[model samples]
Target: MGEWRRCCDNAVCGDNAVCWKSDGVKLKLQGENIQPANENEDLKKGCYNYGVDIADAIVPEWKELWVQVEPEAECIWFGEQEASKKPNGWWSFTFRNYLGKSVIRIKLADGREVVTDPIEVVSPKTPLDEQCDPLFYPKFLRTLIDDLIRYLVSLPFDWEAPTEFATEERTQPPSPIFVLHVLAQHADTICYALQTIWRNPHRRLVTEERWVLLSEASSVDADTILMMLHYPEHLRPYRGNSLSTLAQRLKSKVPERVFERRVTETLDTPENRFIKRFMDIVLYWCDELKRLGYWEKAKSHQPKLEDLQNFVRFLRADPLFADVSELTIFPASSQVLQKRDGYRECLQIYRLLHIARAPIFDRLQDAIDNRRIDQLYEFWCFFRLAETLAAVLGDGQRPYFSTLESDEGGLRRDLSANLGNGYQLVYNEQFEPIWKPKARKKLSYSVPLRPDISLLQENRLLVVFDAKFRFDEKDIQPNQPLEDEMDKAQQEGEIERLAKHADICKMHTYRDALKCRASVILFPGTKGAFHCTNGTKKDNPCLLDIVQNNGLKGVGAVPFVPKPEK
Candidate 1:
């Protein structure tokens, strides 16, 4: 018998003893469907093994099976088999650094071929708390609201009563009724201020002329001769002749009638006065707000106030505002006020300020007092997660998040990113609604499986996270034999060893029912670390760890601790 014959059994060479047969042969691959490992590991350290099984029932001669892997882009396979040996119908191979799906191909000695189902490799990236700071989200939101408030407060409120109307002449007697026209006056001020803010600097060329008497005549114009004759007594003698005849005696002898003319020029505008006054008013308002303790009362608002102050300074330094006249008060009329765009904008700003201030103030105060942080907490988590995804994916692959109301009246939010590949990542999607048994009598009701966060690739759920807002420490003791403890604890009535067990159990339920590769409970902790645990163990019920086997199921906890005060 050849070496190939030594590897044959009754299973491979049953009826055809002379020829190798491949009739009832099939290839099978087996491994834990779910593989859990750190993302930073390289191919060699991260790779796992899958057993290859060849089932041949009726061949007497040795048969060979050649194995291959398909779609070589995502992964590389090692230990490719061309085995004639049965060896209990199994062999093993390793796959390294693989994600997504790969198919296994088997070729028999008799030129027949078979293929196995696409093997899925699941690798979930670990989430870091530092990437999504809990405090930054709320602070960012508050700053936006505060900026709106500051802008609203900066609008001019005082209006100048129109003392004279453009339609009425100066000769026309002042309106005997003395109408105030408050709206028009206010509108005009707003229009003027906005125009001043937005308009370019005004400039004009100015020329000034002056004349001076000189001892010599540089160039004699008609005016120079007239001046010399009119002031004759002031002239001195030239070339030994009387000053009166010097003009006739000498052509250009230090001519007693000399003239000097200078034309001076400048560029000037009225905008500088306006800009200075406007800056003064802005500074005054800032000082008043500070003096009144508005920013101090809500310290979180100080950053916005400082930003507004800096913007005011920027406006003050702008050359465009240099020529605008300082407007102590605004003048307006009913017709002019309606026609001006700036007036309309100012009115809109005023309305917006009035509408936004009260609600935002109340909401912010509630957040600071911790009276309404529950809703804020949920929002913060959602915002942070979305931001983190966008940061990681970059502009080309940034995801968008949207909130929808489910039929059951619960809000559902999802973040979706298209990788441009065949796959996509959809996070925070709720499971389909279903009706399950609630009582022994077979009564059932709709139950929606809503995880706080879920990551899905194509149709497969990669992982799920539940945000829990409570301490997860359990009171159970480890290493104590249950029999001894049961007797001692029962006599002492100490049966509360399962504290906080429900949290881990709930996580397990999510993992099993959702059919996700892993489920994690995100809770608040001091150290911001990840702990994994298995639900089957009775001891250390709250302990969390990573478990990847039999389809990659795991239950774990990670902390999203709050930022400390500076």
Candidate 2:
């Protein structure tokens, strides 16, 4: 203290501040205005540091704030974290809002966690340029992270490459790899992200690669992916939220570094060795269940009917599954595991062998014993054929019914309509109606709206569903990343669009189509926009926004944009 101050030299303040201590001191903050150089273990002695009183700092805009997070768990694309016993006293990560984030969490050993801090960023620099901002941390960067992570955490398996269904003719096999390209810029990125996770009619008809991209972007891991493949049938198709909200939640993962089966030979040759090897791995896991007396467990307690139903429904949750747990062909009472959700039952039996001493590898072998269906999700694959069967049976009931690529209207059409047209179609030059139909029966004219795509055949209703597409300049690809302003605007606009479509259709068209009764605009919705319309006012805009959050699983809509060029 004597030399630090140095005031004792001349009993006066030093001319140069250099006379102060050479090393910086730790400043303890006390209260709002006091800051002390040191603390003697007494709370009251600490000094108080006054924070800056900058303009508009109290309620700073979140858009200007960048999230600063430490490195999180990473996984290779389409890979998976091996399921293992979690540590005691530790709870598993809840994937509630993490739909868009990666699923295969490769957690730290213990006592490790992720923390998000805030970093101030100038709004001007937040934008993107055409030159592809190389190191940009775009707002939708999180989406890429989510997709990447999901793919990394979830493990995967594949069946015969070209499938053995058409083995007689050895021909070119479709490329198994699917890549989804999005405009390099941020503005369109958000909309593209939503399109991925949001379920659209005939989503399957879209090329497999596009679907996988969206699913991958949504942090849907391989396991969840398998479950999606085995989803149960429903009377109505899902139509609630627009595809955008679901996209923002996912993170991108590193691409797969290894390939499972790189095949060049024709399909008719001996069964692919890689597929056989994969089958072996699956079967090996099943063998252990048999050894544990799972086979001996009496079917007396479990009815064949209930078991089949349960199996189909069990794997509906996208986060779980494989093929049916077994590979056996069954009577309707005991159909092929591959024909339904039998894989769930197969995994259920594995709980019998979790003992510390029994090796996990041995359990795997048990699944493949005697080239059986085994205790894995192989049975889940049977679902893809449900639509074909439904057409044959014509019970007017099928396990699945879906649209194809042709189902989605052309991208050009959406661009023309949204960028230009309104509700009028004037083609009077051709052989038009000789005379306008008389203002017959009813004296009412209402604005037309969207139609009902979720109808069941039993309803005897023929509702027309016309989709509209919207294009944004933000979708252009760049060598570097660009800003995502358009995405924000689109999200806001989409909510309004869905409500407008629904309201006008329900009130006008469907009601006017004689006894048509129900007309709805099944459009895409944002995450928070898919709210319920309580007994509220008739004129509320974005009706879905008025009530509690349900979901956009069953909404109808307009046209679909094209695959991103980027």
Candidate 3:
């Protein structure tokens, strides 16, 4: 064992075994037994405690070892008196006051050096905390676009496709203008539909009055005679004011005069009403995009905006809609805008409007750029898993997965599969047990168990997976036997030895509390579908095989990498 340890220190750990600083006395590294950072715990920004342990290295009373931080950054280190504590060393340094990724390196007095795995500094959940590397922007946009496209594809036929943009083309290594193009195309379709409805508006006959010229040839009614007498020039043919001649002349001669007459009128139809309503919505979106600062970012879509303006102009110019004025206030209910012939297109347009109006869209760019990376990662996980499961079940046997629902907070999905046999598979996010056992002294309450993805068969949990946005391919390494012993020792110390990977600890909690067959932690990485499993049984837990086992138990971590471009 010493020889192995020596070999490991020579090759891997350098001159001394290096471990992460856990507390005042404990230093943990290279074992599953080491507890991971607590999820519920919060660490203040700036200076915090950090320490490291050196294995089998003799320290003579007082000596200092050099520690290096990569990317060539300087770190403040504690003095020799602090390092003299034989097996372990303590240090204090202020961390960078930002959230992102960094690495730490340690150099021993004997000239051997070891590098720690990448460490992620995460910030508390806030709108301003979403700073990320610029390189990830393109990938994030692609994922968001794919999710949206899938959502559109999943919609029922009644809500026709809002854009001519193909999902495949839009999702291909998205450009800065990609989102703009998508929104533009959607707006263009809506505008075209509206223009079609506006060209030939529905008309109805309405009774109205018009002035008509009456002549002597026209039948002389008593009203006409009185009207003609009021204007004497209308009876100019009769020169004398003799009663008998005037009476005789009145029967024979009368000049032309104007009088009000009833006639049918053509007015704008009900379809115009819907078109007008939709036009207002379009204009509002254009204004809102500008207000939300999307207009500047999406400048490439200026042509689309011009097209919308032209559509609005066309709607306003048509004589049928001459009286159709801008609605000062929109109806609380969309039902007021009745659907007609092109109602499907109108409905689709309304749907787009509804989406644009959502607050998520207002902060969509910010989310894609920073805050929603983890959420997008989770969404991608769900999408990939659902697709994989559907493929395994065959086209006819594909499970029905619900649309991803995202709020200001986060994302969720529901999925179910009926194999026609007695067996069934169901998946849900944030599932809660209907019944919870009551406590003798306190009120019973239900706690919601939210797993990123959960698989079940006939009301039995098969597997639960959590999506972790952090990149750590090394953490996925299988558990070592040395870890078991370390864990036992830690347990005797009255300190629980949780999984060194926080995500794994979370999975462990879900498995024990839910009593599910297995739980897995999923991470986003370049590694292609790596799976590590732990269980007492012989059968390995994969997506397809979990349903057959009666008492399957295990926990694992899988890396979900994007499929390579062909």
Question: On lDDT, who's better, 2 or 3?
Answer: 3
lDDT of 3 by residue, 260-329 (tens): 4343545444445656776665666566656644454444456776677677766656676677655555
Kindly list the per-residue Cα lDDT of model 2 for residues 170-253, writing each as its tens digit.
132211111010011111322232232223201111112223323234344565444343432211233335643432332212
> Lowest-lDDT window of 10 residues in candidate 3?
44-53
Each model's lDDT comes to: 0.39, 0.23, 0.44
The alpha-carbon deviation from the true structure for residue 429 of candidate 3, after best TM-score superposition, in angstroms, is: 2.7
Error of 3 at 126 (Å): 20
Error of 3 at 322 (Å): 6.2
Error of 1 at 540 (Å): 14
Residues 1-566, candidate 1, lDDT per residue (tens digit)? Answer: 11111123336534222211123543332232222122213321212211111111111111122222221112222224233322444443443322223444455455545444343322222111122333322332233233323322331221112452122113322111011111112334533555554563334456333344563334456766666656555565456544535556444243443554534332233333434554555455556556633444334344555655666667666665554556654332333333444434443333322221132223333443332333334434444443444444335443442223333533222344443222334444556534543321111123456676665544556667766544243312234554555556557643333223455566767777776677776554433323334444332223223321232346666554434233
RMSD of each: 27.8, 31.4, 16.6
State the number of backbone clashes in model 2.
89
The TM-score leader among the candidates is 3
Ranking by TM-score: 3, 1, 2
lDDT of 2 at 54: 14
